[model samples]
Target: MTDHIDGALALSWMNTFTEDFHAAQQALTDLDRQAGDGDFGTNIASALRKVVAELPTADDATFASVFTATANGFLATGGTSGPLFGMWFRAVSRSTATEGTDTDLLAQGVAAGLAKVQTLGGASVGDNTMIDALAPASQALLDASTGGLTVDKALTSAARAARAGAASTADLLAARGRASYVGDLALGVEDPGAVTVAIFFEAGAAALSA
Candidate 1:
């Protein structure tokens, strides 16, 4: 069994994970220029910067505290990524408030995030959006939990699912976001949102493992 993650650890993890999001944003922006708008990197970086600024002080922090701070920050500073990321963090915050952070808690948090994204974005599995990565990663974590897998094992599963989901986008036609405007040209390229979601999952998994 893994130890519970407290407010301090969670805050540290989020700050560290921000770097991964930045890298993923750059990668996605590079990909996007070939098939869609090229501003995803700048947008995600800007939102993450706000998220870092809005993180709660360690003394008063709870999962909800951190998430709500992130949500408010993103909503203020980010465009589409703001609302979407804010919704994800808000949902996860709601789910994790009572549970703290454990393998099961993490899974629940991811599930909450996925539900928010689906509801807010109206994106399904094949939509070539963040849902492509998040839905599968959430389900994989859930399945691992159902099988009584350890936190480490479940996180590994989710990471694999996220990566596979991101890769799968290579063949998908975009159905939402700016990429959708490109039609068939969007095929053979990964969705920036999906790639970024995968990066987030991977970062979370790594942080938990640490």
Candidate 2:
């Protein structure tokens, strides 16, 4: 119920994300094969594994430092997702750093990350992309923070929204990213990116609540 997400919580979040990525790797690969290239699972998994391995050893070990390292590491990757997600991590790092120890830090970080993703990806709420999950979860976190909800409650609410958003993509045609090429073929298949974001929120909530 603490408002602060200190360095410990930040490291814990990354660990949870890494574990979640590992758990979902196969499912994400399978989902990607249904509509786009099948490498989403492997690529994202490898990137997160790198983050887990490298970020925690920084001299400061602050929340900002860990997330900043994550951003910098992923920025080195090739292709669209790498740079975009790298920017997403950067936004989160900057937002939290700017907010200092405020109770709303996590919400601000998530919202900032989602904004960067929207800007870079040029995708909207129902685009059958990660934005589907990210947008809702960001809003939920913002709402919870504004309403003075505890960290656990806010993250849990955000996780629920993210999962719902990801599931809703199953019936929508792909309106963005490589999946867009599949057109109707993407229908009935949940977007891999959206599912990944769902995993992220779910892990964050679990880590904070635990």
Alpha carbon lDDT of each predicted model: 0.77, 0.81
Backbone collision count in every prediction? 0, 0
Residue 165 of candidate 1: its Cα lDDT? Answer: 98
Off by over 4 Å in 1: 97-99
Residues 1-210, model 1: lDDT tens digits:
455556765676577668877656667788879667787778778888887788888897776777677777666765576688778877767656454666677779879888877888888989788889888999998898688787656777888899899999989888888788889988899888778778877776787677
Candidate 1: which pairs clash?
none
Candidate 2 Cα errors over 4 Å, as ranges: 58-60, 97-103
Q: Report residue 70 deviation for candidate 1 (angstroms).
A: 2.3
State each model's C-alpha RMSD to the native: 2.0, 1.9
- Candidate 2 matches the true fold with a TM-score of 0.92
* lDDT (tens digit, per residue) of candidate 2 on 1-210: 756666777778778888878887898899999999888887786677667666865345777887887887677766667677889888878756533333487788888888888887899998898899999999998999889988778888988999999999998888888889989988899988888888877887787878
